[model samples]
Target: MPATATRADRSPRAAEPSPRGGRMGALWRVLEGPRALDVAALLIGVCTAVLTVLGLVMVLSSSSVEAIGSTDGSYGLFRRQAMWAVGGLAALLVLRRLPLRVLKGLAWPAFGLAFLLLSLVAFTSLGHSVGGNTNWLRIGGFTMQPSEAAKLAMALWAAAVLERKGRLIRHVHHALVPVLPFGLVLVVLVLLGRDLGTAIILTGILATILFIAGTNRKVFIAFAALAATVATAMVLLAKNRLVRVQAWLFGCEGLETSGDPCFQPDHGIYALASGGWWGVGLGQSRQKWSYIPEAENDFIFTILGEELGLVGSLAVLAAFLGLAVGMYALAARTTSPFIRLTTWGIMAWLVGQAFVNIAMVTGLLPVIGVPLPFISYGGSALTLALAGVGVVLAFARHEREALRREGAPDAPTPDPSVRPQETR
Candidate 1:
């Protein structure tokens, strides 16, 4: 109420939301206010929900024959997958409201717990080998891959560390020193689990985070090349990995005459090849009838292609690309180095995971049991991914508020008075 202030002198309450805001402005206020991040979440959410439903249908198609013999009902695996989908969505909704700071506080503990689980699985005698990887722990009727949690924990921890020691991030000693122990820990845990795929994904996330934190580019590149070398070596040493790699690179050169260790990839390639342009039909995928292995998990995209065609598969890929683009865009929009780094890291993680999964299915890369996010048929992976999405959404919402508060000029509203000039 300054005396000199008149109605015209006052800033317009511009019908549009405010745009000028900083980090503190993204915090959730005590009073209810407009949510600015809903749009991003909605975009991601709609895609996930669609994929979830699609997953259930495909799981039913892919799992029924095996389930009929393994369980009393034909829908056993599909039923369980559906339940997990429902539960995962609920968990994501709950997480969407929490502020990023709150989650950051829990990051260290989460990382510790994830590491503990990885160790426990090795000793407990409960860890079962699936497709030659001893990474799954079964408790009662429930089973989960601890590595999924490990991935999220690692990302959060990286973000926290980089945020706290940002200035030293440019120095080799301080920057790489901090990440060295963590990298070692992750590598050892994953090596013990024999889950090289998960380890590779973690490496990608770590590298992205480091680069964003201003680590020396040459150092980052050296670390990356080293990781690639180790991964290739591990694959070459293991029969399972070798088979997949051979299948991917050579495409069944003299292998199919005997035992066919790379049979799954061959089948996967067949499935993709069968689907020319459109697809066979919805729920009518011939390859899912016990042809391709892990039809619902590692090779779900192939099934999507087989049933829905190249168009469907490409659509899914395009959506993933769009999501990554949007996430990175959001990160860049914010000035906070932490948000920027974390956002880019997460986006890289998604891209790396997606490419690896799809590549494994299409026989372009060696098979490692990574699932397509949101679309694959696994509860633990899906749930952990949803949580990550929640983090991004909260940041996005805060970002929108920040944009509004910063007094960013609103996009021009439609001119009701002016109709567009139509072509004569």
Candidate 2:
């Protein structure tokens, strides 16, 4: 043997693997088996369930006074939200049981359906306006917001298109051909309805999908700048939107302003400030009793802060972070392009919307009237967000099934005493 080889063999370090290699091997050992997907699914499911249950409680507490004043009793909004929650859960279970191929096949048609519903908002007398956004489709007692459905449809459609293009998706034109048209149409329809919040969300889903599909940075930046310009123009064109932006910038600072736009934002700040480190206790938020508008809908996070305190608010934030991490892990575990894109799109939409809602309530951003995903009290929003989680759960289970077919062994149980290490 050569001198170096003989010296290496004699060295005690030769018997042990390098730390980086050891960690990589251990990770592969853990993930190569079938249990990784199961753990991911459990984490996602638990986080979602906790958020759902917590949301129901918050809705009950925040909407009680309004419910009693508007209707007959305190249970009015709570009952409605409970019904929506039950429906959302059933939809989740049903979607989880369906095959991926079926969902892929339905993607285009679903997008079309979502588009048709959104368009109907302009022409149909059934279109209902609430809090200045004419995005609600109410036919008698049956009411729905098509923009909520549009968000999921947009994600599914983008994923399917990107998967179909495959390796041919090199040029910007190839990437933008169908997605831009579809996304632009949706954005225009939403803007026509004057729902800037949902419009921002739809744009975000498209932007994220395009970036993930390997569009060049120059192209994405150009598109982003164009989007910003258009959004700014829209804001300036509408007097109410301009007022909201102005109010958001100066109203929180106790600046002199004469408008109703600052009303809710100011109360939202008060709610958070009054809560301090520990809240005044659940069901005891004074702001919910007509002080804050949309207490259970858009401004629900304020109640969460006021009733549950800073600790409770942070707990909810942590739960969302956990869900996002778990979803991304599932995306990483998959090889299918469609699965990866779909997972990422849904993750961005839900988490992105949650942050936007929270920021608006906390006075970090202008209020655009988006709900807090699973934690807000909107039937369509809650149902679609849960359905997105179901899609993720299905992907996780699909991965598990794939591992089984590959004859992977059961993963070794992790020891609690072992400190986890990262590979370089």
TM-score for each candidate, following the candidate numbering:
0.83, 0.87
Off by over 4 Å in 2: 1-34, 252-258, 408-424
Best by TM-score: 2
Worst 10 residues of 1 by lDDT: 27-36
Residue 232 miss distance in model 2 (angstroms): 0.3
Worst 10 residues of 2 by lDDT: 1-10
Reference-based TM-score, model 1: 0.83
Clash pairs for candidate 2: none
Indicate the residue-level lDDT of 225 in model 2. 93
Best by lDDT: 2
lDDT of 1 by residue, 1-424 (tens): 2233321223232124345466434422201133324444555666666666777787787777656667458888777777777777777777667776786787789878987888877778878778778889888887898888887778788888888887988888777776757755866787887888888888888888888888877787778788879888898888767776676677677763455756777778888888889989877888877787668888888888988889988888877865765575466456666667767777777767998898778766777788888777778887787777767776776666655645446745446566757998
Model 2 / residue 144 / CA error / Å: 0.4
Number of clashing pairs per prediction, in order: 11, 0
Local accuracy of candidate 2 as per-residue lDDT tens digits, 1-424? 2222232233232244433457657653443333556767887999999899999999889888887756548878778888888888998998898788988987999899998999889678878898788999998799999998998898889999999999767787787788888778988999988888899999999888888878767778888898899899889998788878987776635544465777788899899888878899999999998999769988999998998899889989988987886787677667778888988899889999988999989889998888999888888888888888888888887766765655435645456666668889
Overall lDDT per candidate, in order of appearance: 0.73, 0.83
